[model samples]
Target: MKKKIFLVSTAAALFLVACGINSGISSEQIGLRKASLENENKVVLADINYSAAQPGEASVYDRSYENAPPLIPHSTEDLLPITKDNNSCLSCHDKAIATDVGATPIPPTHYYDFRHNKSMGDVISDTRFNCTQCHVPQSDAKPIVGNTFKADFTNKDLLKKSNLIDVINEGVK
Candidate 1:
């Protein structure tokens, strides 16, 4: 009985060794980039080309999904680096000025404090002040990985706009 068990274990080990040897994967072919795992110099990144349209001139992009943050369609070269003292986006995108400037208003969710569950009045919540954290400028670069996922929205309006404040607490007790 002992001899039979030893033979079976030895055969299994040898089979596993043979399978590993037959596996054609190498260290360079391991990841999606197809570059050497140990060397960073050989990896070449795809170029990112962002839209050069000025604010309020670029066409708006549809939301990627329900309540997904809207992408910045225009060049943000002048409006970036949102410091506490300076947020150029508010000049047009603030709730008060957006409509007048033909820009999408900053959603009500940006003004409400979720942690304390209270309105923050006209001021944007500290957590939501940094636009780039959730929103990014649209780019004309090819995707690293192919995406087959499609977004389905119950309301057609949600495809172009966010209703996050209205839907945030829907299922929550």
Candidate 2:
């Protein structure tokens, strides 16, 4: 029984070594590709070229599809940490003052409390209070990965058939 056990252990050890599993170095040391940002020289901590957007100067980006959340077209440097009582965004984005302030009005859908029986209300719903949750401020930073995504509007055939707004209003039926 002792000889049989020794033989089995020796065979296992031999098999591992034969399969090159005993290599002292990691798989990364054996020609594994490094991250896209990693380089042999010139270590970059962060994107140095990125700058904070100026107030009311941010360029509006086109939406990818119908009902897509519009990107914030201005700086939101001090307008954050939305609380129960305070929301700086509401000063200009609220329906009553948005047109006068030249800021886009918050969508009517934002007033509906979807979680609480989808009831409509006068004020922005609790679920939609934080504007930044769905809307992101545009930046000059380039994406790490190439995006091949194309919107439906780009297709000439679709445009010829009917306007995008008409199709969206008709629903998927």
lDDT of 2 by residue, 1-173 (tens): 99999999999999988778666655445442332333445334445342266645555566655456776667777887777789989988888888887676776777766567454656788777887898777666666568998666645444222243334436556
lDDT for position 38 in model 1: 91
Show pairs that collide, candidate 2: none
State the displacement of the C-alpha of residue 136, model 2, in Å, after optimal TM-score superposition.
Answer: 0.8
- What C-alpha lDDT, on a 0 to 100 scale, does residue 70 get in candidate 1? 88
Specify the highest-TM-score model's number.
Answer: 1
The reply for model 2, stretches above 4 Å from the true place, is 1-43, 48-55, 116-119, 154-173
Least well predicted 10-residue stretch by lDDT in candidate 1? 24-33
Best by lDDT: 1
lDDT of each: 0.90, 0.66
Compared to the true structure, candidate 1 yields what TM-score? 0.82
